[model samples]
Structures are given as C-alpha cells and as structure tokens.
Target: MKPKCISKLKITGTKRILQISLPSRKCKSIRVSPLESRLNTGCANSPKNSSSPLRNEQNNQKFISRYIARVLAKPEFQNKKRPIKTAATHRRTNSDGSKEPLSARNNKLSGGKSSCKNSDSDEKTIKKGLGIPNPDIQKTICRELSKKKLYKTNDTDEIIREKLIEAITLSFKTTNSAPNTSIDFYKLGKQIGNGAFGKVSLAQNRLTGHKVAIKIIDKSFIKDERTRRKIFQEVFIMKKLNHRNIIRLLEVFESNKNVMIVLEYAGGGDLLQIIKARGRLTEDECRGIFYQLIEAVKACHNMGIIHRDIKLDNILLTSDYTDIKLCDFGVSRFAKAGEKVDEQCGTPAYLAPEIIADLGYEPFYVDIWSMGVLLYAMLSASVPFKAKNLHDLHKLILRGKYDVPEYFSAEASDLLNKMLNPVPHMRISLEDMKLHAWYNGFVPENILDLSFNVTRQNEILSKMMSYGFPRDYVIQSLNLKDVNHASATYSLLDLESSYNYT
Candidate 1:
C-alpha cells in the first residue's frame, strides 16, 4: 500500500528456490526475507550457541519446504515417473527399441458405475481372474467341442452353416408367433451368474430348442434413473453392434416385474475363466484372441460407439474356444469424432488415465487404453496396474507405472506401450494397429456385422420376405437399429450370412 510493494526472484540452474518476499510498511526496508522477522524476534540466545525453539521452528520449516520443492520438481520424483521402485540394476526396453536402465531413464511420464450393470469391483474382478489354475470338467468338454467345430469351419461346411442359420431363423419365427409372449418364449434354465439386479441363466428357445443366456433383471431393484438409462443404452448399443466377435443380443423381453435379455450363449465361459483354467496363454494364442478383439473394437469404433469397459470378464469364449466374443456393452456410449465426455464410468482397473484425471476424455482413445490393459492381462495373467484400494489404484494409473513381463516379445511390448500411452492424442488407433508388426501376416478373417449391405440388401430382403416377416417392417427395424423380435430375426440371418465386415 505504501509503495506498491515489489518483489522478484531468479532461481539458479541447480534448482533451488531463493527466499522471496515483499517489503512491509513497518519494516522500513525495500525487501526482506520471510524468515528475517523470525530470526530477529526469536533469537533469545546467541545464534552461534542456540538450540532454541525459534531455531528449531526455522529448521523445521526450511526442511519441509525444501523437501516438498524437490519432490515437486525432480523428474524422477515428480508425478511418480517410475511406479514400481526397483534397484538401478533393472532395465526396461524403451519404446524406440533401445534398452535403458531404470535409473538411466530417470524420468518419463506425464498425465465406476454399478455392480449388476457391468461395474464389478476391482476385488471381485481380480478374484474372478488369474485365480483358477485349471479348467473344470465342463471347460474341458467345451474345449473338446471347440476343436471339433474348428475343423468343420471351412467352405465345404457351407451346408452346415446354412442349417445353423435355419435353426436360428426357426427359433425366432416360432417363438415370436406365440400368443401373449413375454419371457414365455424362453425356457429359463440353470443360473450361470447372479448379482443384485437378478441372475443370468442358461435358457432355451422353446420353439427351436436353441440354447441362449438370458439375463433376468428385476426392474424394482434398478431403482435409479441413471441405471435405467444405462439399461436402455446397453440395448441401444448391442443391437447396432453385430460383429463376428461380439456377442449378439438375440432379443429383449419385458414384463411387469423384469426384463429378460437373451444373448448368444458362450458355453466355454469368459476369457477370464479360460485364463484361470489354463495358466497364462502363449503369445500366439494371445495374439489369436487379441486379433479378434481388435476386429471387434474396430467394429464398435466404426459404429461410433465406445466400449468403456474392456476387461477380461466381459470376453466370452465360444463353445469350442476357437474364438472370443466381446460382450458387456452395459457401459458403452456413442461419441462423435473429437467429442470429449466428462462422465467417468468403467471398471477401476481398465479406466484410462484421462478418465481418472476427472477431465473430459475422448471415448475412443479410452477404449484403446483399456485394450492395452487386456493384452497385458492375457500375456502375464495379471493386471498391468494394481493397488490395495481405489485411491492407490488411481495413483498407479496416473503415474503410468506397470511392469512388462520378461517373456513379452519386442513387438508385443511395443504395441502394448503404444496402446497404453498416457497421452490421448498420442495413443495408437485401430487403423494404425493394422500396420503394427505384432499383427504382421495375421490376416483378418471374413469379418462381418449386421450393417445394411446394399449389394445384398435386396436379396436378403427377398429371403426374409419369404420367411413371412414383411419386407417394409424388416427394413425399418434394421435401419432404425431397433432392438426387438425383427432385429433379432435379422441378426440370426445377417450375422450368419449378410453384412460384410468391411
């Protein structure tokens, strides 16, 4: 107030803060150290001989400030650049394919929803994963079935494929034609899994005797509006998603008390189950599963959808375990190009750093990060980052701390790093993924989805019309992405025959 108090400071390259303060009127000086007054007033004993309270206070403050500044400034300490503390002897290969010591790379770095509806706790997810050392008798049976089926999945098996489609079509048409149907069309079987909302059971199409997994959700238990919208959103997304690697939503049935979602059954169980049943997967085996996953994710991205959750639990195995089906779209959302969403929702471990940062995140990039986590799990049989609690988990994620198993191939490790990059703008994309060396010579199969294939639209329409579903109604449902009996009927045919993977 007296002279518009001015102060300035210039820190040296050695990286220590210089004492700084503005002058006060009572001080009658142009400048002063913040500690100057304390030095003057509390020097009861001679400074040279003093072990006084004032001296102790001054030392304490100085020590604390310096410690904090160093922690905040040092590259190695700042933001916890190196997560897992190890001796300098350990080395990790850099992204550029060069090896560097843990100490040499001194720095680096920079950067939940519901139980029943696909937001299981980290504890539960971990417990369910990497715990089973061997597959039970049932998984072994499915494995055998899978190998047998794989041998039959060839061009010569066209008749078999047609028969399968016919079976699916007959189930849809016969069950839908039944009078006053809700869940009556399905004969619910054994409970496969259960949660607060309800149980997921093995069910049969009463008309065609096809086995499916029906998720029974009690409406009253899902009391919140957000949870209800999540249900709608899940249906909205899964209906539009018709990829060879995605679990198909056969149909939805609603009544006064519950909503039953009939989905394609994966008898071999989820990826987590298979991982537990057999120790970790070999790189080649993991690559096969991962390749299908990449295709599945591309399909989702092409449809402008973001599957926020992409962990082990949601990856189901086909009856023969020949392939995987990416399921659980309960947390998926539609995000236009470059749009950022602020809502934070997903499993704790699979969440991208930006989502944990509480900043708006590009939904598509978030999927890539989660995919990286998935690959890590498949390779090592453990999550990349883990902590005792949510808060610590967030800390680990923000620091970009994770160990690459010694067994990983250079290509596999490099691809994983690109996908898990902390910077959103720098993250590897699905298109770029096709060029990555890890996928070299790994030709993608005849990928297909439930999209409108103009070339074959007329032909398929004629075929469906032959089946008695009015051409106009079928066309409208497919175009509108409606989740109902017609859409289900279309899927049985489209996923089996129509809709190119392009």
Candidate 2:
C-alpha cells in the first residue's frame, strides 16, 4: 500500500485468488496445505524436526502444502466418487396406471399451505437422515414407498390409485399407461373405487352428459404377451355378461397404447365399507346379504365366467343396499361351455386348498372357497385365515385350518366348515348351499328376488350391524351418532323373520 501494491490472480479450477505483490512487483501466492500441516505437527518428535519454533512452523506450512496437492492429485478416488440415483427422486406409476409427479400432495410451512417443490437440498436431507441398509425387505418397502405414499387421505382418482398401487406394488408390478386416442373418450373425475387392474374413476362421457366409471390401465405393466391377450379375453367375457348382480360395461375404447373400459357407476360404495362402518349382521340380515352374494356368484358360473376375484370389496351396493352388484372382472377366466379351469389366480386369503395345491381344481370351487371367507367375515367381521405371510396363509388354507370364535353361532361355524373344506370334491356346491339349514326357513325358492328388494335389504344391513357387532367396536368403527338408530334398519314389530340370525 506504501507504493501502490500490484496483485496477481492465481486460478484453481474456476476460482481465482489474488496473490500479494512485493515492492519489486513479484507476486507471492500464500497457499496452505490443510493435510500436510496436520502430518508435520503430529511428527514434531522426529530427529530431523529439531529447529526453532518459528523455523519449524515455516517448514511445516511448506510440507503441508505439498501433502494436500499430492492427495488431491489422486485419480482413483476422484473417479470412484460418482453421483448416486435415489428412489425418492424418481417418478413412479400409480396403481391406476397413471404417472404422478414425484411430490407429496400436501405441503405446509408454518401453517401456510403451498405447493412445495422437491429440491436437491431435500434429497441431501433424506440421504443424511435415512441411512437405509441395503436389505431385501428394506429395498422392497422403499420400492413401494417410492411409487406413492403408503397412506393418503385424498379420494382424488389419481391419488387413490397411487395409494392402492403403493399398497399392492410389492405383490404386483402395475403398469402406467392409458389407451391413447384422438377422441375424448371420457373425462375422468374423482376416484370411485379400486379394483385388481387399477382403479375406477368417475369419468363423464364428453359427447353426452352421462357419467360412467372409466377403468384406467397402464399398458407397460401388461408384462407378457399372454397376459396382454388375457386382458382382451377379460374384456370379451365382460361384454357377454349381463345381469342385475353384475356391473355392466357400457362401451370400450382403445388407442395404440391403452384400453379405456367404460362401466356403469355404483353410487353407493362396496359391502366391505358398509360392514366396516357398521360391524356385524343379524341372522336375517346376514342371510339376505349372503343370499345376494351367492346368487351373484351363481350367475357368474352360469355365464361361464369364473369370477377369480370375489371378495367383500367386489360386491357393491346400489345407492340403496337393495341392489347389489358384483364387479371386477380383471381376474375372471371364461371356461368352455361346461369346462372348468384350474388356474392359480384369485387372492391368497380366499384361495381354495385345491387351487393352492395346484391339484387341477374347478374354477367354481375357488369361488365357493372365497364365499366361505366372505361369509366368515360377515358373521365375525374378520377372515377365516389370518397369517403373517402368504406362505403361512397358503399352509393354513391347504390344511383347512380356521378357528371360528366362540362368539359365532354353531350354525355359522357348521356352514363355514362345510364350504371351507380343503378338498375340492368335499366342498359344498353352490346349489347345495342354497338349501343349507340356515336358509331352510326362508320362503319362496327365489330368495334372491325377495332379498334384493329395498326394504328387506336395509333391514338386514341394520340388524347385522346392530346384533352381530360387539357394541363398542361397532360404535368406534362407524363413527355412529346413535348406536341403536345406526343398527335400526326398520321397525322390529313389522320385521320379517328373514333377518333374525340366531
């Protein structure tokens, strides 16, 4: 500064530092060796290090500078440090075959709601916090979580499929593309419900104001060519099927990439949600619902469509509980005129022992097995076999091991045991089921027509939830205002004996 100092710039990578200038204008760069300084300081007791403190400090600085440069110059370590790809950062397909942007639906900062952007900084935080070990279970769980959040409160069509897809992704790898088309087939709205393939969205027909549930499918997940062909086969089967108990397919549209299936919308939700909200059913109410369920299954078998997937979720109520519809033909297989299939498909929990054993059992037998589980769940609010893993579940199913709680009546136990027999030949036929002791008292051979009526159906739902459910569990599950009124389907004085379970 005494004589205007001239500084020279030294460059490292893209960064430049100014070097101090001497009186002669000779610039001297003060470079520090972070590693070398530590090594020299630690080696102070060496014989060659005998020097004055100031001299030693000056020599140590020079040594440290060289050490840092030597370490920095190593190519192997530098080459090994590649950027990592994280699961959370990737875009994944939802259950309904839609690719959702990778971000949480809800974002709030200090109670202020806003769309939060996913950033590298957020990735850094995740890397630091979640030191997830590379184990198979952890990897599987992560893989599922990456596609969609485990649980979501949103009922939006896209988000619902996302959640359901995430739930089942571990077991099933769903595809993520819809049929591409020029025509506006339907405008998808909020999610109506979930099915085996993906989800059903309440879509409006663009041309007409008529509303329909559009089933979305991601083409990428079709996997094998046979599976893809099976999808078309299912569509063909659904086309021919027509009945009151079955949800009808209105139209079919396809683009190069996806198939858009249009189906009638059931305003009321599924039987599972109703039973979950209510709890248990009375004998008459149980009989009523059971009769409808059996009739629906019978109808499918009659049409040569073996409904591979038949559970509480597949049976939906028509606004009023009177009209019940069996849906989700995704897993259904059509047998020849009188032929029965032996495919290992249907849900594990509901799988008949013969199907699990691969013993070439009839498709209708699997339906009966699932019905048994359905009946058990209706009577007791739980499935017959509850195991930790699918293998154990199959073992229990094959062993024909299921415990009917003391709370269940002996008649119910007898019925469940009859239908749940592991041997396909031993299992009771649907026709024989119609004549069971529990249903012996009901009038008119056409129990289905009588049960399908609006007044009788509601009475059954109310009584089943009221009498069958444990009071405390029923109230908690349903969020009921009055437990009594909630269970009250109709006046007991004028009530038909068709609903009395005991």
Candidate 3:
C-alpha cells in the first residue's frame, strides 16, 4: 500500500503548534527535500535509521516529537578526539596536489564519504571539570552556521579549526563557547546588480569558495508595512516553491534595520538585457525560451500561486544562457480556481484588460494575460500595447488594438491573438497554450523528476546536527516558517543538491 496522506500533523511549541499534511506516497517526489514544508513536501516514508515501525498515528506523532525533542533540546555540540594535537596543524596535500590543514571533524564531513547518520553521533566525553552543558554554547555554534554570509560549500577543511580546537579545549575548562556568525565569514566581492529596494553584491564563502548573490534590502527604503509585507510575501512564496525554472532562495536573514536574502547566482543576467542585446530573436529561439517560461508559470499555478508580475525583466537567465529562471515574486499571491481578486498592481504595459477596466479579475487569467504580453514582447522586442500615458495605455489594452508584427508566422500570430484576447473568457488555458501549433517541434531539456530522496534529507538533517544545529530546530523552523539559520542551511544544502553537478 502507498504511504497514506494525512492532515493536521502538528509540531507544538511554546506559543502554538504548527501542522503539516503529508502528500500521498504514490505522488511523485518534488524538487524540494522531504523535510520541507511545501505542498508536496514529502511522503510518510519511515526513516531508514529507525527500527521502530511508524504504523499508526501515535508512532507518526512520536517520530515527529522525538525529532522535535532532539532539535529543540538545543544540545551543545560535542566533539570526541583521540590526541590529534600534532595532526591538527599539519597540512596535507589533496589528490589534486593542493595542501590545506584539515581537522578531525573536517575529515568526517569533507575528507571521507561517510553518511550523516553515522557522522556526528559517536559519544564524546566532557572534561573532568565540566559535565553540565552551557545553554548559550548551542546558540553560539548554531549562529555561526546560520549567518547571512555566502552559501557554505564542501571546503570544511578550510574552516578555521583554531576556534573548534578552542571549543575542544573548553571541554577541559567549562562548556566551550564560540562567537555567533558575523559578516566576517564572507569574503565580500564587487556589487553585481540593483533592484528597487536594494543593491545586490557578489560574495564567496570563505570555507568552500562558492559564489552567492546577497540582496540587502534596507529598512529606510521600505515605505510602509504593506511594502514590507510584500517583500516578506516574496520570501514566503519563494520558500514554498522548488522548481528548476524558479530561482532558489537559499537563505534569508532579517535584522532590525535590513532584510538580507541569499539567492542562486545567475551570472547570465535578466531576459530584458538579452532581449535588448539581441533585438528580435528567431522563432525557434523564442520558442525555446517560452517553453521554460511557461513551465515556470505552470509550476507556480500548480501551487495556486499567481506571479502577478510576469515580464521580461522578471525572467532571469543562467550564466550559461542555456536555461531561464522566473523571479521577482513581490506581487504574487495565492488563488483558488475561479476566484477573483482586485488590487490594481503589476507593470503598466503588462496589465490585463479586466484590470485596466477596474473589474475584479481572476488571478490566473490575469497572469496568463501578462504572459501573453511577455510572449509578444519576446517576439517583437516591444509590448503590443503602448501609449504616452497610463490613460492611453489602458485604452489601448482594453480595446486590444495592438497589431501582430508582419514578420510573425501564422501559427505564432494565431497563438498570440488567442492569448491577447480582449474577452478574458476566451483567453487560452495553459494546457491549450502547451498544445498550440506554434511550438510543434519544441522540446524542453532537464525536465524535473520528483523523487523524494529521504536519504538526502536524512543526510542534510545529520549534516546540520554535525554543525551543532539540533534536528528539532530544522523541523520546528520549517513548521513555524521562521526564516532562520537551521532552515537556511537545510535549504542551502538542498539547493546545492538541486543543481545538476554534471
């Protein structure tokens, strides 16, 4: 029998308990790890390391409780060593011939291929003078791992083991403690891009040397609570999404003054720059890009999300220019089938006719309309409807008076007309758009196959624990939706695995 889908699985806390519903086991695994809180989060597949059977509700709750207890207990990280003082400072050459000092812990994490389940669990002794754990020690270690710095890589051997050694020595004194994660952890690089809210910068993880884009939104730039909520909403929606076509939000940190978001580095830049540089692209090339865009939109709509703003500027291309990722969810929101929402937003040129007419519009159809505008712009290098002012633009959009470029083929024109239909009811559905003859020979590459890798999830769970994060912290963070260190590391690890290493 397939793992049954159950609702109301609650993880309780001091304030209130958070609940998550597991999808049916027969359902395909998603791009997200099994431990996430997404719609298709994970199956009820029992943990492989556990011998006790999760055959009923009580057992399932017990598993969650134990997991939570393990994490929330926030136990101090313990390290067991067998006299490696001399070996600690000795630099060893890798097979590649580069030499770097590797700590005993680094060997378990980076040198060897041991799975996380067995990595951090070996018993270690507290020194004769100290047996009681210092409560702050756990936070200090966890904070170091959760910083808003570069996404950590496999360069564990490079981490300053001196502090780790100090902590180990602290085992001899009282419980050991280290500083919380700080900006010092990142090797800051040049500014890369800018947005309405903040500037983007490039940074490399000091340990692994991996590059990441950090978007820092200053509190002063935020005008009001509504704008602040929109930014938070973007983070929320991005967290729920785990598709290849969408940019991964690796980690998030909000301070009293600024909101910092770490994202995948897309060196290829946005679609607007590409469209401007290339001008009018060939029909074949446009179809290729559109395929991915449509797939991204489909993925969002599947999760009942509407990317209220879909335009050339919002589509990000990969460094290789081989793939595109949809981004900028500042105006997105959830909607049900046939549900209508009103709140005139989105770029002027991409607004649907219903929106221009002040009629409450179905969110899905509005997104489809914007996509039509995008497709038109992709083909002609400009929006179909244009005017000197908002009044004139609204008029042109409501009348649907834009002419199809003479260069467009009949099939392309036909599809565009259906998409640009003034009658909202007549707009082509996503299914019809896929079947449209304009894309007769188009094929998408690297199609995502959802296979919930519980092992990978366990591996991450173990890795976090090894770094001093309690397992319960990860689960609780996901449940509470706190965009903090434990959840960030899990998402970062999952994002790393998400990329095609080949």
Candidate 4:
C-alpha cells in the first residue's frame, strides 16, 4: 500500500507536503501530474479519490493517513537524502544579546551597513576590539559612519568598504602609534610674528620632530565676506604653488574659533630684518638673493597669478641665507588673459606708477616695479623714490625720479633703469629680466619647466597696451632686456634735480 507518486517530502510546522512525479527509464523522478497528462491527451475526465470505503468518512480518512505514515517509516524511505543547510542558516548571538544569522551580522558590521540605531552597539564592538580609549573620538567615528547609507553590491559598496577600512586604521593608529589626543601632535613654542590678521607661533611636531610655523587666525576678526574670501584665496593659492622658492603650506585646520595654517619655518627671518641688520648686502649676495626672487615671481606669473603686494618684508630667507621663499599671498589675485586690475594696493614705495595713478594696470607690470624697488633697497639700503607724503611719493614716481648710486655696476644700474620704467608698457618683462647681464648666466631651473595659461597671458598683454602706451614700445621693451645699447644710467644727484615725465 506504499504511495508510488511521492518523490520528495518536506515538513513545515504541523503540515507535511509531498511532491508527486512519474518514474523514468533511469529510475529518476519526472515532475508531471496525472491531471496534466490526461488533459494533454484530450481525455475529458476528472480526478477521483482511490480509497477503501468505510462506514464513517472520518474513519476512512484516518485509515489512509496511517497507511501513508507506515510507508514513510519503511527502511527504503528513511534512507533517502535531504537538502544541505545554507550559510544563512547558521545564526549567532552578538554581545548585545540579539540573535542574527552569522552571514548577515558580518555583512552588517564589516560592510558598514549598520544605521544610527545600531551605532552605539557598533561603537562598543570597535572600542572593545581596537582598544580605543577616547569615547569622544569613538563617538565621532560612529556618528560619521551612521550618516552613510546601507552598503549594497555595487560601486557604493566599495566606497563604504574603503571608508570602513580607513576608519579602523585611523582609530588604531590614533590609539597605538601616536598620542591619544590631537593636541599632543604639536608642542607650542615662542611667538615668532604677529599681524593684523593672526599671530605666528613656532611649534614642533612631536612625532616627526620637525619645527613649523603655525599661523593662528581668529575667525572672529574676519568680519566681512571680502576678507573671508581673501583668506580662502590665500590658502588656495599657496596650496597650488609647489615651487621651491615659495613657502609651502603644509596643512590647514579649522575649528569653531580659529583657523590654523601650518607653514615651513624660515629661521633666518625676512629680507627686511636682514637689510636692517647689515645696512646693505654685497653685490654677490644681492645677486644671489635677487635671482631667487626673480625665479619665484616668474613662477607666479607663469601660473597667471599676481602677488599685488611684493616687498622686502614679504620675502623670507632660510637659516643659512642660501635661498629665499616668497610668502604672504594675502593680496594675490588670478589675473586672467586681457585683464587689467585697477586695485590701488601694495606698499607706496613699491607701487607702480600706473597703480599710483589709480588707473587700471597689468598686475605683472606692478610686480616687476616692486621687484625693482626691492633690488634698489637691497643694494643701496634705501628706497629709490622716498618722500614725506603719498602725494609727493606719487609725484616722484610719476616723474621717474629714481636714482642709482655711483657704487652700482653698469649692469646693475641698467637693470634698475629698465625695471623702474615710468610707463607700465616700457617696463622690462620677467623673461627679459632673467636674461639681463646682471643675472650673468644664472638662469632659473624652473624657467622653461612651468606652463602658462596662454589665453590669460594674451588677455593681460592686450589690456595692458590699451592703457595709453604705444603697443610697439610695450612689445619692444619686454623683448629688449638683454639689449646693451639703451640709455645711460642716471646718477642719484642727476635724477634728484630733473623733473622728466617720460
């Protein structure tokens, strides 16, 4: 009385379901119901129950169920194999007393799929596993992780995986490799310099044992949007400038009250301090320092940047005075092609004649003029044009009344004359100045290595010519810094007595 149609059996709760199939030549079960085969063969007949008749219907059903149970109990039926258990069937209880499948729990915690609701438990696990002592930092990490969405089997999952790995590594390193607190990274030393915006302090990195100057700026002092934008621009520009002669901005950290900028320390102080200490530099010393300055300026100009304020105070020297790094890009601006910046900024003595006129001028021309003034101050220990008031100073600069001392060599005086040209169009360009005899084969290593935005350069040059200077003279002056046959160098007394306008 064994049922031949049942090929498989499954139990769920209190019910048992049987899979019916027909036997094939290989003795394997084929899943085809008798009703379907009869319909396909065009036999229009309904299925009939095949059970023994009894006096009571309940008794008959009970007899049929017992008969099937007896067949299932046979040795042949009991020897049949069953399906294997999957990985998801393996469940585990977390330390928090919640039961979850092992696979799902691993995916949730390791894949960063845990939400804010579960962040507390995850943080406990992280702290217990990694031994992180700082509860505040642990909370921070958990909070950041909670903000991320659940991971999926896609690109986002990879990102989440990477973030999880980074968080774990950072936490471990923070606890084991370095100090437990962020403040321990650096030790504050003496106050080095102060300005209207911030104060610079010398600090030593506890881990690397390197000294750096930290510029701490109070956020409250930046009252206006313009000033805030300038601060951002200074940081952005400093980060982009990767030249050896430009001071490196190592890192920037912002908090609720202040913004701290880590910078390379210049132990020898600024050029102004050197000038004040030594009165004037030797020709060889001046040439070496000025060459580095020219290279720095050239690098800035090539990147379409203009340091509106360039002076001795803004130039810094290394401990040995072997090199200089141009710093203080607070007034720097990106001068695009064909653009004429009309901002009347910069030191009065260093300001170009056009800038003093309150008229639009090429910023590169202004930089060159400032460099000329710097060169003069470095060699003569005095500014070329000095007056009691801004009005007299502007007048002197407009009249081209700068003087060259008798001690200056012919090449130095010639370079000064070209750089100090009254007209912005006639001022020698950085390219020609690099080739001047005063430089004496001292070509900048990065001169040709740098790239320029040609469109921006063309725009600036075109706009510069529109400012009342002959186009031909502008081009010629920019190209003729190496030309030996120009004009005789003016003496201090001669320029002081004259009142020329051109």
Top candidate on TM-score is 3
Q: Write the number of the candidate with greater lDDT, choosing between 1 and 4.
A: 1
lDDT of each: 0.54, 0.47, 0.53, 0.50
Q: Report the C-alpha lDDT of model 3 over 186-280, residue by residue, as the tens digit.
A: 45577765555666678664323456677777789776644554565566677677776787766665555776776666556665655555565
* Candidate 1 runs further than 4 Å off: 1-180, 447-482, 486-490, 493-502
Q: What does the lDDT come to for candidate 1?
A: 0.54
Per-residue lDDT of candidate 1, residues 193-253 (tens digit): 6533566788765434556787788888667654565566666667667766788777776
For all predictions, the C-alpha RMSD in Å is 24.1, 34.4, 23.0, 44.3
Q: What TM-score does each of the candidates earn?
A: 0.60, 0.51, 0.62, 0.55
Error in Å for residue 117 of model 1? 20
CA-RMSD of model 4: 44.3
lDDT of 4 by residue, 327-360 (tens): 8775566665345654445555666666544434
- In model 3, the runs with Cα more than 4 Å from the true position are 1-182, 446-450, 454-482
Q: What is the lDDT of residue 42 in candidate 1?
A: 4
lDDT by residue (191-232, candidate 2, tens digit) is 754433455577664323345577766566565544454455
Q: What TM-score does candidate 2 get on C-alpha atoms? A: 0.51
Return whichever of 3 and 4 wins on lDDT. 3
Worst 10 residues of 3 by lDDT: 38-47
lDDT of 3: 0.53
* Candidate ranking (TM-score, best to worst): 3, 1, 4, 2
